[model samples]
Target: MIKKALAWLECGEIKRLDWYGHEGNPSQLLGDKQWPQRLLPLLITGKLQMRVPSIHTLGSYQNWLGYSGSNLAVQNPKLNISSIIKTKEPDFNELKFHLTGMAGDGNKGHIWLLRLMQELLNRENQTNKEITSNLRKVKLHFIGLEIDKSASLARELRYWGRAIMGENFDWTAHGNHQDTIRSMAKANIAVSCSKAETFSMASLEAMHLGNLLLRNRTGGWEEQLLDGINGFDLGETEQKPGKKEIELVHRLRNTLITPSKKLTAMSIAANKHSQIFQNIKYANWLLN
Candidate 1:
């Protein structure tokens, strides 16, 4: 818009306006060092009205408000843009887990998952007075591979899975990637134990497959997840939901114990509610 306007209007004219872009600043086209310093200054000074999607260039793009900000509505009032939109998870109904190997490794939330599992198991055991009630209810399947593909992280994840499962837990560990995907397909719910995420593909994929998502609160997860509606959002300390992590664990246990059929109903609601946002709509808005 700015370019055509500039060409049509008189040369050497400048105007004060806002500019936006995705991933990186458009002024960077001038040159690496000079993009921000030289060219963007000219455009901003020259009255260019630039707008970019906040999700694509969130922290990097300047002059534009964050995508989640209210300014986008001001600029384009008619556009119905949502932050994070997902599809409903499938109705597996039977509580099964196919934790991705990639998740339980790296400097990510692997340890957090272990700790959460332990806490949940302890709580479940206390409830039934058997100490193994929770462990017995949940069956984990490790689908992604490790060492044969030359990934040390994979090997570590496999070892950790085995260690966590132990002899008493009714769990199985597999290294076949295809079998893992199949297991994920058959599972009732998907659990994402990620520490940091800009957006969650695993969580989204689980939603797409009609499996209810049980995930942590961080990054773009908040934008995508609708607590108590589509799925459960855990460990949030805010007053809106008014529950801490410990409380969230209790709620989770309560939900699980109600019967798989009830959970399946929640999963259906989750999948139905996730269709509000589409990537193409976001893309078109950006291009517009």
Candidate 2:
């Protein structure tokens, strides 16, 4: 919309522009960057509007707004929430994990899958006595476009994981959104790894499901994940597999290692916190 807003506004086709985004301002929109309509007072004045899905983005993307002329950004960014009906998780004895929104490389789907599989391999080494209640026969499911053929290391790890863990540890890859939602309904935990984001929908959905989130705190995630409250805190996103990634899995592996007072409280808090977002009426939010 940024690219075409100038032309449309100049042509008098779009008098005012309202752009909505879930992520932070694009890199191109930062620094000494120009909004195409900036120079033309008649076309630019009160014409370029950015509507971020979360108000938290206002503070998070402050730098971007600085160089990009924040005068036009007077309106508050509103939170965009979906009405996902809270469903009851199915009765199951085994551990179930839902890796949140692996929408291809941007979300680093392959990295998350590999780290989880690596942790599962670690669990395979432990005997039934060594394994905790959370480690016995685990199941993880993710749905999205598959990683490209060039992701050799990730693919190799997955191969080894399935070969060693066999049916005892099922890591299912899916493509259907409906099925993924259903799978989430059955999961007890969620691991959503993203390079960057601002109040992501996937994270919101996971919280609404009463699933304990296990993601590296990124962007506005801090506003939702209260460290060991609703989710464990990792430093940041990583391009390579590292301790943080493994620690994420390790945390999940023994989330109930000794059963702390925070377990059910975390889920309850996550569900409760997400409900604030759910209450938002998008149209009314945008207008007001």
Candidate 3:
């Protein structure tokens, strides 16, 4: 079906072909022989125009083509800041760490949350602990929205999390947009474990709702998430929890036991950071 449409467009009287490329859906011309033979000639002849969300993706395509052309770096649509209602005070009796996205095969890297949970449990079991008494009283709950229910890896991870965390973890394989927003509202921190992302709408929404973002350093997340300010990056070089992750855990533990004033202040800072992605700014960029 895609081939037929491309063929028609190639032969038709169209002025130009505008295409959107990302990690998942790259240009067919950069792929196997079948489509490239049919599509590359047209693309090279100056008939094709492309738009990508990030410089990283644009560079990949440019390197593949061996030269730059009409590829434009138009970012993905930003979150609507107005729709998110900032909470003045969020209950921290049980520190809710929420992650929403696909889960399976480590594609979305949702399994990292499970790993972090295991690490926390291990620390709690240690004989000699330096953690404060108030920090020990703060419970942690992992809430996940698994967008892809059929993903085998995600399903397996969910089962493993339940087995380990028991009642401390909850996974909703099928959830609507509203359900995700509600989860964000109640969450103390929003976590993303994806190995890569063109742009993470889930993380952005979490920030808009004034939840501290705990995201991996990848994709457009770095653009909005400032370490130690709006959120903390889970390091880019390696996967395992290192100094940054340890510090983040410590901070979360401390935040849970801190007064509401400190939590509210953090929320306000996150909300301020999220303002750059407002719909008005996105509209102006698009228009220009």
Against the reference, the lDDT scores of all candidates come to: 0.49, 0.57, 0.64
lDDT of 3 by residue, 1-288 (tens): 556657667888565666666663365434764554555566667566556665545666665555465534455656765556556565555567787775545766666667776776666566244555545233333345444546677667767878778877776654667766776687777877777777677777887788877877666665767876776778672566665675567566663445556665666778787777674354443343
* Candidate 3 wrong stretches, greater than 4 Å: 1-12, 24-30, 33-47, 67-70, 81-88, 91-94, 127-130, 136-155, 237-239, 255-263, 280-288
lDDT per residue as tens, model 1, 1-288: 745544444354544334444324443543455334433444434444454432423443444322233322212112222322333344442346555545344534554554555565566656755423432255555445443566666566556656765542222344453444455666656666554443455565556556677666644455556776667766542322232554554554453455556666777765554444333353444443
- Candidate 2: pairs in clash: none
Maximum-lDDT candidate = 3
Clashing residue pairs in all predictions, respectively, total 12, 0, 1
lDDT of 3 at 208: 79
Winner on lDDT between 2 and 3 is 3
Q: Say which candidate scores most in TM-score.
A: 3
Candidates 1 and 3, the one with greater TM-score: 3
Better of 1 and 3 by lDDT: 3
Each candidate's root-mean-square deviation in Å? 8.1, 4.9, 4.1
After best superposition, candidate 1 residue 78: deviation in angstroms?
20
Roughly what TM-score does model 2 have, to 2 decimal places?
Answer: 0.71
TM-score of 3: 0.77
